[model samples]
Target: MKKITFSLACLLIATIGSAQQDTYVPKKTNFFSDVMFGGGLGLNFGNEFTNISVSPTALKPITENFAVGLGAQFNYLKSKGYYESTSYGVNILTTFNPIEMVQLSAELEQLRVNNKIYYPATYVSNDFWNTALFLGAGYTNQNVTVGVRYNVLYKDSNLVYNQAWMPFIRVFF
Candidate 1:
């Protein structure tokens, strides 16, 4: 029941985002002219821990206030001698700005998580896939947005994030 409602909502947003204006595209430009590329590179290192990630996204605007996009995620994590793992995935995204400063967004992310845990004298390895749907609202300027989003599918058993609510800062060029 809940999943059905969420799927419907996402379909509605995608339909809205695909309502093209068709007024600004030039005839000779490449397909990427109106496409926006964004995402981030992150690095976290301490004495005995390390984390690295690379995310790249591309979005195409159908109108001045609506856009749809996709992104790729790659992450590497190491906890000294405890464990080391890698996670990679892809995501779909959509954003709609009803007014100049307020933006609504929906993101569907699918990730494959690989983990290695060390025990007293043995270690275990496991691989699995995790999916998350995030609905968010944000304050936006021309190239940046700051906001918080909630994962509708979050549970205590999820190993990707410790909390269902997370803050985000997005900058696109």
Candidate 2:
């Protein structure tokens, strides 16, 4: 009789202890909340140079560790000798997270640019298309990310060289 009662007491204690520990099963989350928004901004000024840039992006999480997105970019510049210029581009971006805090990113962009150059007597408009591939690494947290990107195809002394490396910050809402 003691043996049977002891076994029942043990079983009851086990059940009560298991019930006391809360097993957190996360609720189903909405797709829209799972979506993240982020982008980068840039500004520079000097005696003969001024530059401004804006780029905004939206990302859809494919899984906990990967995401794909699209972004639009715009840039404006004015220099002492060179005429003011405007450039715009569209980019496709992908990011992969190997760990919670580290991210790897890539972007393919095509930009259409307009610049003015001195001709024999007057300034003439020069137009060109530039393609750039950017790769980067970043640190990320729950609501913010900071990273640096390098243009693999950057060319020195090239009008297309807006910047060779860019640091970026993104905030998610």
Candidate 3:
């Protein structure tokens, strides 16, 4: 009788403990008003040439770790002649904070680029980069966060199948 009673007590305690430890649910936050701005540089190597790009982005938090933002990129090439391109896009981002200083995020971006040629009057309206999907993981300190992202380009008719290991740093206010 004592053993049965002790088992029942243990079961009850376990149930109560589990009930107290509920999973986290994210809360909705304001947009535009609570926005963050940051930028980064990346090196892109292609079949044609290698170049560097400067990208600036804005992030508006929708929840504790979820945000949506816009980014603009300016790329300069240094081989096989000189060319430049400008890209603009929007991304929906979700950040998961599993630990105190670790964060994981996934971003879906829709991007468009305007390609320009330096020599002669050469420009194409439809020579644009397509939408891309990316996933990233990073570590964050008090005010700065750095991460790497893998970008997959969906449409490749006009552009090459390009993949980039992009590192970004963001400042939160």
Candidate 4:
């Protein structure tokens, strides 16, 4: 009985002597320094279809849950006997992160295209403009993100493309 009482007293004294302490504190970061860079690139080569596309973007995190950015797009496309086109555009981007690994994104883009049509007798050039609204979801790892987006406002005679669906990959630096 005496040994048991002594052990209990020692345990209580030790527990009171060693107190817990908070060891983790987050450091504040600068707003301008907290920026991410990413974009997408695509190239297709074949006898019937050949194209090159590139887009580069920069983003600034406004809050823990929201981010906004801007991007530029350039594309060159050619068909075997059809026409060749060069297009350029600018985009505004917005992204929301409900979780760490997933993101919801929206973009507004305005593009201008110049096309040269090849004909046996004569060649003609045309210039046009297109505007697109893209909405999609993305999966992001530490530094890479991949996603698919659809142009909700797509038209057949748009300056850029007739396809409504587009896949994208981005790397953040």
Alpha-carbon TM-score of each model against the true structure: 0.82, 0.70, 0.53, 0.73
Which pairs in model 3 have colliding backbones?
Answer: none
What C-alpha lDDT do the candidate models reach, one value each? 0.91, 0.87, 0.67, 0.87
lDDT of candidate 3 over 57-113, digit per residue (tens): 777766675666666665555444555555656666666767758777777766676
Please identify which of the two predictions, 1 or 4, would achieve the higher TM-score against the true structure. Answer: 1
Model 4 backbone overlap count: 0
Model 1 TM-score (2 dp): 0.82
Q: What is candidate 1's lDDT per residue for 1-173, written digit by digit as tens? A: 99999999999998888875455875797878989999989999998999999999998898999999999999999997798888999999999999999989999999999989887898999799999999999999998999999999998876788889998888888
lDDT of 1 at 56: 97
Q: Write the per-residue lDDT of candidate 2 for residues 93-130, one digit (tens) a residue.
A: 89899999988889899999988876556888879888
Model 2: lDDT of residue 41: 89
**Top TM-score hit:** 1
Residue pairs clashing, model 4: none
Q: Over 4 Å off in model 3, which ranges?
A: 1-33, 40-56, 72-80, 116-126, 154-162
Positional deviation of residue 144's Cα in model 2 after best superposition, in angstroms: 2.1
The numbered model that scores best in lDDT is 1
User: Candidate 4, residues 1-173: lDDT per residue as tens digits?
Assistant: 99999999999888777755446778887876888988878899997989998999999989997989999999999996779999999999998889999988999998898998889877789998888999988898877778899999998776566699998776878
Q: Show model 2 residue runs off by greater than 4 Å.
A: 1-33, 42-50, 118-121
